[model samples]
Target: MLDKVHDLFRLRTSPVIFFVSAGLIAVFVILTLVMPEGMASFWGAGSGWIYDNLGWFYISGLTIFLIFLIIVGFGRFGRIRLGQDDEKPEHSDMSWFGMLFAAGIGTILMFWAVAEPANHFAEPPRGESTGVEARSMEAASEAMGFTLYHFGLHTWTIFALPGLAFAYFIYKRNLPPRVSSIFQPILGDRIHGPIGKSIDIFAIVGTIFGVAVSIGLGTLQIHAGLAQLFGVSDADWNFIIIIAVVTIVATISAVLGVNKGIRRLSNFNIWTAIALLIFVLATGPTVYMLRGTIEWAGVYLSMLPELAFWNDTLADTGWQNGWTIFYWAWTVAWAPFVGIFIARISRGRTIRQFVAGVLGLPTLFTIIWFGIWGSGVFDIEFNGDGGLVDSVLEDGVETALFAFLAEFPLAPVTSAVAIMLVGVFFITSMDSCSLVLDDMCNGYEGKAPLHQRAFWTVAIGTIAALLLTATGEGGLAALQEVALVFGLPFFILGYFIMYNLSRAMREDAGEVGFLRTRRWLQTLPPEEYERRMEEADASLAEAVVAPDYAEGTQPENAPELEHAEQPPVVEEYRVRTGETPIIDPANPGDTGIPPRG
Candidate 1:
């Protein structure tokens, strides 16, 4: 029994990464506990420094990521599959999009879909400079437009860029699914060195804090919903209990693995969210929302370029810092967690497919989501009582959604659904994040031991609960700022990832040439052609891993190659390409091609 207990907790991870990440997180929690006021002030000062100095850097970096992904997705690299040539996507399209939507911004959309737009409608950014009167038709239009901007393509691009790099390296290049592995093209063998470990450490810590902020936000939102529905006291103990219960559910889901737990919950979240959205649209002013959605989409697209690059430089209103800059930083902080999770489920997809699904689909859903909720709130403010805005301003953003729902029919039912949706979203995000954290810690070898995932889930929940109990909303906001500060490094790292991915893809393109018709090859016997295609895919996979083999190394946690049935394909590939394929005897694989001299 003791041995089994030990086995459950045993980890296949670098001591440096595991201990350092835990140590940093422990110190953060301790500091927050010991000197909550000082830590909050420190985080405030750090946030101010970043906002003053690096606000434009964040905006420009996100814009570059969007442009780079667009170019790569639509350009020649779009044709490159993330995995072997013949590999097909593991999850179906519905499940894939479901997971993406659930993990990307489900909880946030719930929390802010109505609150943000209403706030903006009350006081538009740059209203003084633009001469847009607050709460005017113009302000209403700009409000939804900005909501779409914050939740749209540029935001998704943060996740997409890292997801693309991770997918390419992990699925195609057979590198371990670590942030540092994407840098392998540039770093080579040094990816296993201190620099690589340092990158992973940052990823782990960033992921934790980022997810903790979300957990904190979700808990607060849940508490607000409970208070509204049941008259529950807004006590810290209640918040702790909420975190504890949700963490337990998330831990179980994490242990169940992606297919069984995460995927199902994600599908449920999407469907439930859709039902709730339809409830609003159908029961409320359906025509207005439908028509407004089209108009808002156009408005969003028209304003995207301006909004994407706007840094409040000309006006100097400090508005962008609180809104646009904060959103960008928050998304950057979330990139590692969301990116890796997206990458894990995105194997066997083309770059174009990944980008289109990650950026396009989510953005479309977001536009509709905000369109329904934003337009609903704006309609009430415009035509009905203007109390929705007052509710958001006075009652806090957490209660805004429920308060909005209360103005409609079946307020109780819709509010309950909304709360349920938030809870499920909370669970899905936590489970997915915990899984990603486990992967990073174990170097992405395979499914991590269940205890390790449970540990992360507990740690995240405890941190969130402690932050909530200790410093309440102020501390949560300060911690979120610190998460953004951590994101600055990732923003810098994004450029290097883009460079490395492009260089690696360019090299591969040079070797393999571009996608072309194989009419002559197809004229052969069907079985023969199939065999040839399989051999080609095997050869491509080998080519990707050949460099590591040449250097007598393998990525940490990479699976050993098995040679039981792949020799003929390698020989066939060698004969056709007129290139020698070296085979490593120690790690023999029928499909494994070794380093070419």
Candidate 2:
């Protein structure tokens, strides 16, 4: 007990950051519990004001990230490796992808997949409400399009830029892999100073809230699943108990280290998610699901540009505020956790491969996932007598998935599977979030102390439970407000990541950097460029030895002399093009020994 206490109190991290983050978290928890209504009102109004005023900024930030990431992936910067020239990926492609999906936004998708699309379907954005009723096919199609927009490439692009920047710097430049390190090119060694500490502190705050959001959602869903499956009560205490159990399990997993605990859980989560998806696709409206998936992909593609730029300012519809803006804020808040964790596991990949995997593969999974659940549920609720939408409208979003599952054959089994998937995703996300927060809290030096990880695991669950209890039914909204408020600075900080990444790429000594215009080319005329190239080539070639002249084959120009009377045969000197002869500046007449002829 004494040793454990000592370990917990050890100052392995920056003191300022550690205390400040802890203090802030404590303050928020206390205030939320003591003044629940006031806390909710403040967070809601504050974040809502930002969303209403700066919706354009959020839209533009996401758009810029997507555009910048695409440019990096396909342009001259594509071929640059994240590590040294010969290094390969730490994890295999399969392992990497599984982990990425598990750690990135797995739990978020679980909560939002069925709920978000259905909510959007009931209240379609940018459409005449009188013309399209809830559960209509038009509402379904429009919902899928917008839902895809919410969880699609824009989010991953935000993740990829920072991942690439940090990976390149950590592996190539040997800098610490922290959020603050992304500014090293602009800030220099001061990255270890006060400014850097402030950046990391911000990241820690964001990560804690970001993780709390997942914990809260997972708790709510798990409680709902229990009620749906076993006829358990959905009391707030039951939810608190669920959060406590998950937090304890997550702490154990985090203690087991990344390879053993986190990686295995991630792999399991992916396969479980896949099984759930397949079961839904096979057992539900298989034909409609397939057809709708095809159509939804096309719709998302066609509507992407307009949707990407839409702020709904003219019509004053609050849909963007509730959905798009909230999602952007959530993703931005979680960017550090996702980005840093990806960088940690992605040592051997090229910039292009990382960008593609981060932006494309997971996105493909997201689209197919929304297709299977969103389209499948829509078919039942609209055409069949399923009442899934009614359940959402009446009960809440947390009950949507379980209610949808209850309609199928073997309803109990499917509901149980959904619960298991959420539980696994919850554990995996917590462990991974702990890893990233640990890395940041410890100055990106090494693995955090075990006790520190445990503290954070507890802190995450505690804060989540406090907020949930404090706000009653408004817990998730309060968490979303927290995400939105913290996300504002990071949205701006993301641009700095892009600029610094490009600058760092330009300075790399590898293939990517080689493609940039040489300084001599930029500063010198064509004649000077040719001259410099010739000089460089000549300097490199000068290491080769000249042909030997044996005693009998001495140069014919050598003076003939008797053996005993011969003046020492003088070595001939010549201007060598291929060899670099060392010249002593102070004693230019002196020559070092050369190779024997």
Candidate 3:
């Protein structure tokens, strides 16, 4: 009976769904373009408000800092050595780390590798835009610097922190593989049940919402590139088209299983992506690219604090809110699926090595990609008469990228290869999502049954296309809100994992007995060890509770809030009899009670 119910509820996710998705898009596009003022204006404004107003950035940054402490706490003090004997999970041939890590971050990286640099170059940042306009080297470097900040160390670091926390909890602590699982060690066993499942549902749902934006934005850009570059005309719903092809391929790959299909796909995508970056770096502009690299690096290093944790609510939040906060939330929405994906992959690795590799290595690649792609754009701006930047502005982001390369040295070949690069990225992301959404729906441990992953992948893409057509840019706007809601709690969970893990490790690493000889650890009274552990527990709590923000102290106003001190929202009201009741402004739905009505 239960199986029958599950089958009924499960989405059919067929070609008909795609056809329905397309019809919806057509209707939505007509309405959106016709009523541009209403749909576009409000969504853009609300997005801006939520973008700048929300306080999640501070919360995410704080968790990142706690992760920093955890890194130090684990290595500087060493650990109890949970002998690396835990069995690794049965997964696809693809290195768990490679497939999951690259897929979640790779597609965006591909798009940004060239597109973002160009996007920022055309309208270099005002904060960094100084001196003469077009001819200035400083202006170009400023553009590259901003993109790197968005994609580089800090942004990806946000992704990795949650991954590390989640991995440690699941693999080391033996908890279920859920976002809330990180808190179970601290919150206790109940987190594995209904309460935890609710949290997982929210995280999973929020993640898919975020991924919907990824599919829509990414699909639109890639499809538009195909249309503009090769003149693939008559493709109204190019994203849905791309989704169909990629989902089919990934589904087949998923069926052969992870090791054969997913890993191969991830590897191919990674290498092709690298080749694409190399093509840009080698063929584009060398001198400007190299020079921009130095300047952006210096600027990013100097302004790291400001860029990573700016929370001046009243200041003109141009980049901070629109770009910085938005990306943080975006990554956070991704935290549940992607973070778990990363943690699942990393095993047999040390605490320090895991943290640094996950946090630092990819960042290095992000910086370079930003340099290569962004520098290419800057070169065109300062050197090659404003052709590329101009084209990008005139022809939209997708066409602009296609047009820029067509004018380059290897025009025909590069454009064709560019298509390949786009395909790998888009498809790789599709397959990865298929795997992720599948597992998320089922238990988040093993590779989801192939048929299931394929079904949801198709469903996710279809929904995104429909929403994109109907809501247009609002779809992207709503996708961001998904992150804002989930990023903070997950960030907090990351910190708890760190704190609890620290305590667990302290006992494990012989810290409690480090002072004692081995003989003492064994011979010492159990009562003495219990008393010491209790003392450690009290100390741990105090150490972990970050102070409230004040002008003088941190946590107080730091972008990375060490701790949050928000008072509970209270609902005050009076219930009345059948008499008409006045709703209080402070508490709506409140019924005013009359003395003896």
Candidate 4:
């Protein structure tokens, strides 16, 4: 009877959901093209408001997370597994990983790079004025550092590990695959019911909305490019048509599956982005960027302690909240989608690898970015009126990038590349978010089908358009609020993971888990290091399974006897070939292998 009811519900509601999702995206493009910049700002103001209210609450929380990463990152939380069968997943090469991972960062990264430096160049943070002597360089350099500081290593860590935990726990421990699966230690078998479904569905919807608007972010850049290059009217229907065509192409690429199309596209995008960076680094006042980068590093490092922990309570306390807490909240809002997306690709990677990757790679890129572009542009600013940066602040992201580009040697060529890079970056991000949301809808975990992926990817943009219409960007703001609301509570898991990570390491290694100990895993060679991770994972999975999985907690369609017949007839799921390396039960896995097989 329940099966009949579920089938009926799925039949009736599925079509409606898909239809509504599709219809909204087409309308969103139409409306957004016609929507005034004032509306975007009105919505963006909400971003400011969040900054004003609970910004530091997030920063302090993130500060604590940094500590957790340091404590657990060594080797404790490494070696996560996902999936019931010990099947291996296909992984990208180093280049692919670099590119794909980079894609999750939204087009906002490109838009902000130009816009923010401009804003700071005019009125530096802390209300510092740039006199004729003060020069915009000082202001711009400071802005870059702060931006990098926030988005750098610290932010990605928060977004990534939760997915790692979820995927690893579900796949390896034989627990239900859902966001709540990570909480099985707390929720037990209850992780399999309505609450779990809601959590997964909510994550799906939230990510769709998030990525949808994010796709829309590229619209502005595209408009900017068109307006500047072809002298096309950004406000006209032509712009919308162009965006539709471009976005469709990107969506199609996603439909081609992760390893083939998405992977190749990301690989290209990251390489070009890096090429752009290298171009600037090599030609853009190399000496100044190097010196300024060192200073930025010092400021970043010295202030790192303060930057992570600052919760100012004094006058203009609003300033503290606006930036810090806003970032934290924004980070949380971004967490589920980014986490899930990263987690999907992160199979075969250990928790240590994930934490380090999230916390290290992005930060490295950000620092180099600030050092190169941020410092180079600021040097130009210091020498003159800093008009490039000034325009970025007064105008918008598009104009700012153009204005800054004008200062370089091959301004026109680089500008073209920058324009291309922005669009590519947006699409890469779009596909990634879409893929993550599809996983949410699959009602199973890990690699979902390409068809579901394409549907959700395009659906996300459509929904964002509609929601943006409904909330007038207030919807986007609302999404941020939702993220914060969801994220603030997840701190418990972060804490629990951190605590367990530390305890397990200490006990396993006897006295060696202590940092001062000679056998700290960090000191091991790469091969030996990995062996240790396998062992640790096997051990942890056993402990986790007895309590969490020892209970009957299979999903309705999980390939267990209960529902093994109904193997999620996915029209477009991917099976990663090499990454998921099944632990051979014949060998009973490494000493640390989980009970996934």
Candidate 5:
């Protein structure tokens, strides 16, 4: 027991990633502590410069990634599996979707489902119907379309690129599961040196800050829920307590391992969110939402290209920075961490299956969710006497959902459930992010030490709390700006990932074709084919029953057995013919050993 305890706390950590990520966080905290005013000014100016100058880069990079993912998903490479051809997936489809939703977008969906749509409706994007009033039916439809645009296929593609690359390398190539491993084709063994470590460290930094943004948002929303439900004091100490409680819950979940804690919690979160969505759909304008969902989906499809590339350079509304650019940066920032979780759950699935499941299903959920909330809020504001638009205008976006719920029966009960759902989403995200961070730091040498995971959980919670507390008045925005700054490098990295994955997939396809052709040759009709089949059967029987059987050795009943039933043999003719053995097309050097006989 004592030895086990020692092992738990032992230094089985990745030296460079661990220290480098830790040092980055330490420096930020120290800056915040020692020179709070100067740090704020520097971060504010730097983040502003980045947003103002590089918005186009973020837009173009994400657009390219989305297009690449679509091409690859429908192309020949889509049929390839992440693992060996014969291996099966580790989790059920439902469980897989649940976990991905929880880790990748659950909290964001919870936080933004109502607020985003309402905000867009309240202030329609520039150059809409000239006379349409804010929150009008036309404004609501445009708002839902915009929401779908932000949370739709493009966002998932950013995640799918990293997840698919890692899955191919880790499962197909038998490589370590690191962001650097995706660069193996480009850098070769140099991936194991400083270049690789630097890549992983950068990913770690992005994940930490990205997840910190989520945590900060979760805590703020939870405080709002508590203040609304139980009338709790909206004090700074109380906010700190909320972060502490959620962090403790998350740490416990992380320690419980993936299957037991994370999976179960993710399932709970999805079911609860579904129930809430259903309640709104059933109780509100069901027909408008149902019909509106289809209409908005169409609008989203038609307007996708325009919305995807729009930088508002000519309009100068600064709307792109606050909404579109911010959402893109947030998605890119969180992709590495969420992609790790996606790859972890996606063993034994084909590239097409992975892409469809990761990109299609979640985006469907986003559309439905925004459809229900957006349409429902519009119904109340424009058609009914509810003052939701007034509440949003008076208070803030965070209060949109609560204010909408206030018009319903059992407001407190529904609000409480919403809070619980957010809390569980927070927990699942925290645990998954910590697991990903542990893998980034320690590679695939089994799970990182318990203490190492615990350290990350603590660090995440600490940084989130400090960022929130230091800014005080508008801390969430401050944290988001910092997170977006870290996401900048990932835009550049996304291009390399697409190239490397494509290269690997082509290699896999060639090997698969070779084996297929060899099998076809064995099926050709002729006396020669019969002779070859008999020889293959003999070779396989001999190899299996007596591996060291001499070439000419035969049983005394060989002639009689020739007339008996003969099981067709599927010999690996390529290896015997001295041709290169079949390989995972994505991994040429990984020519797996051929079976004897």
Candidate 6:
């Protein structure tokens, strides 16, 4: 009985990672519960210091990641398959994109699609420099651009670089599917030592805090929906209840594993989100949204350079701290979780294909999502109906989307759908996060026990519930600060990961030469390609040695092979004869090579 209990809870691998991370999170939750104000103040101060000192680093780091991915995706190394040279992708493109969109930023988009743009429109950034005043046409245009800037390619690139590294290392090289595995090229054996353990620890901790932030946000939005729909009061107990229910659902989904649970939920999330989006476009100001979406793309492209690197050094408006830096920090914090999750599902995809799907498709979808939603809110605010912005600013940001929907027809029905969307998005994010946490804790071996996944799901929900209940009015702010603080270490870790991945790819390219014709090789008739390969092999065989040599003996002209290593001969024999040598396990001394005919 005791053994069963121990087996149920024990982490078979990387127990240190599990214990230390669990301990730290336990301590944090305890302190927050004991003194919520103190913890909140500490997080706030820590967040401020990071933003003031390292905000520029955050901005510059993400920009560099974006540029690096673009170059690698289109560069010569693009043809390198993440798995074997001939392996195909595991999931279909539709399911792949669904998981990517659902895991990466689904909840964020749902929560902020209406609120962020509304906030930006009400108060545009750099009015002194860009001359885009608040609540004007210029502000509205700038708003969508900034929205896209925050949620677009730059953000996805953060996830892409890490995902690419994980896939390349885990699938191609057969490394363990941990964040530290990406460092194997540089760390070598040290990856299994204290250094590697430390890296995984950071990943686990950061992923928890990052995921808790989203869960907390989703909880808030869920509460707001409930309050609107069923007159549920905004109480601490209700928040806990919301988190409890969602966590239970997420745990069940997680226990069902990725294909059975996460993939289906993700597909449902995308379809439902799209249905809601199309309903908004169809019901309200269709032409304006259609036109604004095109202009939004242009404005995003035009302003991307400035927004990508904007530090606000000249004026020091402190705007970036709350918006850009916060979003970037949230994204950085999410990198390991989303990166690992995407990499887990991205087996057999080429680096170029992974980059294109992970970075491009979701970005395009985000632009359309925000364009329609942002256009709706902008139209409302611009027409002298300030209720949506006022509710967001005064009432609460969580209620912004429901309030915006309230303006349209079937307010109750659309609001219910929005609530359901947030709930499912919540479940998908939590379940995926818990699964990744399980992988990180267990060193990415076979499936972890179901209880382990459930434990993580519970831990995440507990942290989010504690933050919301303890911090009271400042719960969301505290969640953001936690994301900002935990994100810094991982953000710094990303550079090392990038360096290691690039160096390894370059070394691989040198060994294999350029794989530019890898795809072209596929275009040829299989018979033709096989014939050409056979002819080339025959020529190489002649240049080396005659293929008539008996097993365990050298040909007369190859006398230099007398002192040469033995394994290369075996390899050459196999390549020439198209047969792998098999040794008898019982005999121990019998060479498995057959006598030449």
**The candidate that achieves the highest TM-score relative to the unseen native structure:** 1
Model 3 lDDT at residue 146: 72
Expressed as tens digits, the lDDT of each residue in 416-476 for candidate 6 is 9999889988898899998888777666534466777789889999889888887765655
Clashes of each: 4, 4, 8, 30, 4, 0
- Superposed by TM-score, candidate 6 places the C-alpha of residue 497 at a distance from the truth, in angstroms, of 1.7
lDDT of each: 0.79, 0.74, 0.55, 0.54, 0.73, 0.77
How well is each residue in 300-402 modelled by candidate 1, as lDDT tens digits?
Answer: 9999889888888889999999988888787788798899899999988999999999999999899999988888987898888778898899988998998
Q: Candidate 5 residues 168-258, lDDT tens each?
A: 7767655566788788667654555688889888898878878988898788888888888889887778878988988888888887778
lDDT of 1 at 34: 78
TM-score of decoy 3: 0.72
Off-target runs (Cα >4 Å) in candidate 1 are 1-8, 511-597
lDDT of 5: 0.73
Task: Return the TM-score for each candidate structure.
Answer: 0.86, 0.82, 0.72, 0.73, 0.83, 0.85
Of 2 and 6, the candidate ahead on TM-score is 6
Q: Candidate 6: minimum summed lDDT over ten consecutive residues — where?
A: 517-526
Clashing pairs in 6: none
Q: What is the lDDT of residue 144 in candidate 2?
A: 88
Report the poorest 10 consecutive residues by lDDT, candidate 3: 516-525
- Stronger candidate by lDDT (1 vs 6): 1
The number of the candidate with the highest lDDT is 1
Query: Distance (Å) between predicted and true CA of 399, model 6?
Result: 0.8
Worst 10 residues of 1 by lDDT: 517-526
Per-residue lDDT tens digits of candidate 2, residues 158-226?
788778887876665556657887887776655666897789888888888888887887888888899
